[model samples]
Target chain A: MTKYNLPVGPQHPALKEPASFWFKVEGEVIVDVDIRLGYNHRGIEKACESRNYIQCLYLLERICGICSHAHTTAFAQGVEEILGLEIPARAKYIRVIIAELERIHSHLLWLGVAGHEIGFDTLFMYAWRDRETVLDILELISGNRVNYAMNTIGGVRRDIDQAKREQILGMLDPLAERVKFYTDLVTSEPTCLARLENVAPVPADKAVALGTVGPTARASGIKVDVRRDDPYAAYAEIPFEVITSERGDLLGRAIVRLGEIGESVKIIKYALQNLPEGPLTVKAPRKVAAGEAVSRVEAPRGEDIHYVRADGSDHPERVKVRAPTLANLFAVGESMKGAYVADIPIVIASIDPCFSCTDRMIELVQSRTGTSSVMTWEELREYGIRWYGHGHRS
Target chain B: MCGQEQQRSDLARRDILAELCARFPGEVGEAAAPRPGRAWATVSREVLRPVTEFLLGCGPGAYLSTITAVDTGEEFQAIYHFWVAGTELNLRVRLDRREPAVPSIMDLHPGANFYEREIHDLMGIEVTGRGKLERLAVPDDWPEGHYPLRKDWPGLPGGESA
Candidate 1:
């Protein structure tokens, strides 16, 4: 069989983000894959150099629309560490509540995307419909759904009052029931199991070696979670179980994410119930002492790390963001080995690849015919669906 | 027993710093554990590979998180953030401003592939031993010798109007 190279999107029209994956396919099996990034670099790190710490907080928040709070909270924590400011207890609980809510929304969104990638439109529609409840809860707490803007330099900007807390608590029971349904559906549904089982299996050792994180890593039986390993905000006080699976395949990822939504609900409920009485924020100093600090948060996708250096000025000297997707992309590329070409979309979606947080660039190369033509992400997804539909009509 | 576990981790963290200091006598500098679960050490550029190899060999939980490069106006620095047994142990290496370069640790940690390329792209650092780092975050037409993250960068090569 002749080897033909297929390049899918730096545009990524389906995901509405920018990333390119060049697949070296031998007949139906993928021999190799090369990922090209950086089609959407906004130079936020360089921009952080000129702005004040408060200003940089909002700038970093825009790094990823899905995990905006995660980025801002990580940035705020790093600055607070440099300032030696411990946020108020109440503020910490609010952060946890909002963080868990964001996790729920993010995971639910991923479930839909994974469903869509596998050509399971019903699952996609159902997962997305359930996601709105999370969004509504987020809006109730933070006044916005996507970016939230809940985090500030010293602490959180919004507070979950008694009434709002009760409302949120009331909403959780139904959401939990919905998530339980998803858990059963993804695991037992023939459409899901057929597409996900034994596809793109990443063993435990390879997962660690390739630096996969969050659900991607957890599904591989690596007991590593930033929320568990390094407790931040109220995670130190809160008690929750770290979910893991030994499957290390696409099915394992679905199970792990679905399981995580349940955990997020529990964390949110606990934080709301134990809401302490204190100020929402502390008065942080404008000029931080000359020092550097690193802040890490387990975002919905994985571990999001931020580094901040203050030169005894209101403005930071340097700021660096290492979003979780960047750490996991290499492992994702490695996982593509021996996977059927039809399994490409779900495999890429399995890591919950967020290219807006970490973008890429690529030029399609015509390996065999010496002729090149661009194919949008949607086209590739449709091709996968059709190919799978023809062979296995599940 | 919880206290003993804490004590064990504390001692383990201390032992990591001790081992680094003992192995490379004059190379390791300004090492400290600011708080629990976070430790940072400044090492000379030459011993960076050996130090990373040592850390990765520590345990299964050890893995490189990401590499961050900073231009401190006086010199360039590359900080390698590694998570080992719940502690974030950062290895900082200083490079000369005129010709900044750091060795590649991709063979040990495959995750460092994009990070080292990123440092090369945004901060204008030469990542030696990593063959042909084809522009990870910059455009193909982006001018050479112009690093956006550098302190001395004068806002792209063109005039303000362009």
Candidate 2:
């Protein structure tokens, strides 16, 4: 059998993210895969150097539309550490509430995407329809749904009032029920089980070696959660179990995320009820003393690390972000080695990759020769759906 | 129970600092734990690889979070942030501004591949021993020898050179 090079993207219409994936395949089995990124590199790190700390907060928040709060929270924490400001208790609790809500929204979005990849359109619709509930709560609090802009240098920008807290509490039960339904559907449904179970399985050792984080790592049974490990905000106070599965397959990822949604609901409920009475923010100094700090946040995807270096100025000397998706991309590529061609879409989607946040460099490896016909990204996505559709029909 | 775990990890973190200092006495500099849960130390460039190897040998949980390269107007600093036992142990290696380079830890930690290549691209730090560090984050048309993240970088290739 002749080996074929199938290039999936620098612009995949399915994920709507710019990332080029070149796969070396013999027949239907992928032998090797190389991911070329940087299609969306905007030099946010360099941009942060020129902008003041306040301006950089909003700029870094735009790093990922899904995890905007995570980026900003990490940045703010780093800056606050340099300034030596301990944010108020109420602000920490508010941050936890919003962070858990963001987790709910991100996990739900990934669930719908995963469902769509497996040719389960009904699950996709149901997951996305329920995701709107979390988004509405975010909008209610921060005035915007996607980039909530809820974080500032010293503390959070908004506080959860009694009226809003009661309203949010009222909404949690229905969302929890919806998550329970998803947990059942993915575990027992034939279509989901056939397509997801044992597909592109990444073992626990390989997952850690590759530095995969978040739900991807948890699915492999590596019980590493930044919330529990490195307590930030109210994670130290909140009591929730770290969800993990030893399956290390696509189905394991689904189960881990669905389980996390339940945990997020419980966290939100706990945070709101135990909401402390205090000021929302402290008076943070504009000019930070010459120092450096590293802030880590357990983003919905995984560990989001931010490094900030200040030089006694309003603007920072350097700001470095290691987005969770960047750490997980290589692991995804490794997991694709023995996977079928139809498994590409779901395997790549399994990491819940945010390529725009991870795109920091570009590579031009034009190693394609004759005999290798390039398939457009759209066709490859459709091929994945159709290939799996055959199994559903059978 | 949680406090005891925190104390154990805190001891592990301090032990990491002491272990490095004992192994490479004069090689480590500017070492301090500025706050709880974080520690920083600058190691001579020559011992960067050996220090990293030592840390990785400590345990499987000693993970390299990311490498941050900073152009501090006078010298280039490559800080290796490692997460060990809940503490972020940052190991800094300073390079001369004229010819900035650092040994690659990619062979030991495969996850350091992108972070090393990124420093090579944005900060113009030559990651020695990594065979042909590919262009990871810049445009194909981006000019050679121009690093965007450096302190003295001009706006762009053709723009006024800062």
Candidate 3:
């Protein structure tokens, strides 16, 4: 039998974002996996250099549609540190509210993707259908499903009015019950257990050595969570436990994420009850003083760090963002080495790979000829033309 | 009581800084309190590897949170930020702008791989000894030699609008 390579994407049905996965397969197992990113790289970091602190909030939010609030919150905190401004307690609670809401939505979306990858269409549909509840809650407060644009330099842009607050609370009890039900179904259900349990096991040592963060590391027994280790936002005040499991397999990751949703619900409820009263935002200086700050937040996927350096100008001297998925992606690649190809999607899905948030680059070379092929911008147009039929030259 | 604990923590931070300076001698950069809870140290790029290795070895639990690179136009600065339970130690390494490459710490800290790639991709600073120096965030077709974060580089057209 001859060996062949298949490039899964730069565009593919399996992925929701633009990323290419080259799988070197011998029969049914992946021999080697090469990832190519930079497909969706819009030069965002570069774009941040020219934008002022206020404008960069919106820019950072656009970094990842699913994790927009986390990115913006981290970015806002970084700027706040530079100016040495402490957000009002009420604003901190609001930030926590939105951050947890974003986590709920992101985790639910991942559950749907994991279900879809395992050939469980029914579970996938149910997961996404229920995920809308979180999205609706977010929209009620922020007025947008994807980019909330709620975060500002000093605090947040919008406050949760009484009506919206009650609406959010109204949905919580039932949503919590549904989440628990799904949690049990995923963990105890025979079919899911068969597919996920004991598959793609990453040892605790390997996970730590690889610098895996978030649930991926937690699943492997590393007991490290940025929220707990280095508390930020309102996490220090709110009480919730960091979930961990020693199994370090597909099921372990799933269990940890599902368990986290329950914790997020608890945190949101606590934050709402303790919500403080004050203006939603403070007046921030248009020009920030020269300084540097490093802010770290625990995104649903893992630790999201942003380093901001300001030079007393509208624009930041430097803005460097480190998304959690970047660390987890390599660990996922390492875990996939010995797994059966049938389990590849489930394993990859387990890490909840978000190339949009995780910066990576990929290059495509033909396996048969071992030659690199360039897809010129003009060729991309032609390819689109051939696929979409050149739209009938009128 | 919490206030007293905070004061004790601050004193401990100073002691830690003093110990680092005495141990490493001239290698340790000036000790300055950046903020209430943070401390900073600048080291030559030559000693970055040793300093980071020493810090990580101090505790079984030390972790490198992230690595950030700033382009000073004439020189490039790479900052390795590490944190234990409550304290943060920032190591700044300055590299010549013309060469703009640092010996890779991926060998010491595999977690540094992605951070190094991000620095490589955005700041155009090469991290030698890394397995892959590929771009992590920028698009594939973005013009080569065009780094957006550099001070002198012209950013995207219609800059503020973007």
The CAPRI-style docking tier of model 2 reads acceptable
Model 3 vs. true fold: TM = 0.86
Among residues 3 or more apart in sequence or in different chains, the pairs in candidate 3 whose N, CA or C atoms overlap within 3 Å are A9-A20, A36-A362, A37-A361, A37-A362, A360-B136
**TM-score of the second chain of model 1 compared to its true counterpart:** 0.87
lDDT of 3 at A240: 82
Location of the lowest summed lDDT over 10 successive residues in candidate 2 chain A: A355-364
How do the residues A272-301 of candidate 2 rate in per-residue lDDT, one tens digit apiece? 999999999999988989988999999999
How does model 1 score on DockQ? 0.55
Q: Which ten residues in a row have the lowest lDDT in candidate 3 chain A?
A: A355-364
Q: Candidate 3: DockQ?
A: 0.40
| Cα lDDT of model 3 by residue, A140-229, tens digit | 888888889988889888889877888899898888998999898999886677778888899998887787889999899777777766
List the lowest-lDDT window of 10 residues for candidate 2 chain B: B4-13
lDDT of 2: 0.84
Q: Which numbered prediction scores highest in lDDT against the true structure?
A: 1
TM-score of chain A of each: 0.95, 0.94, 0.87
Candidate 1 vs candidate 3: the TM-score winner is 1
True interface contacts reproduced by each model, as a fraction? Answer: 0.71, 0.48, 0.57
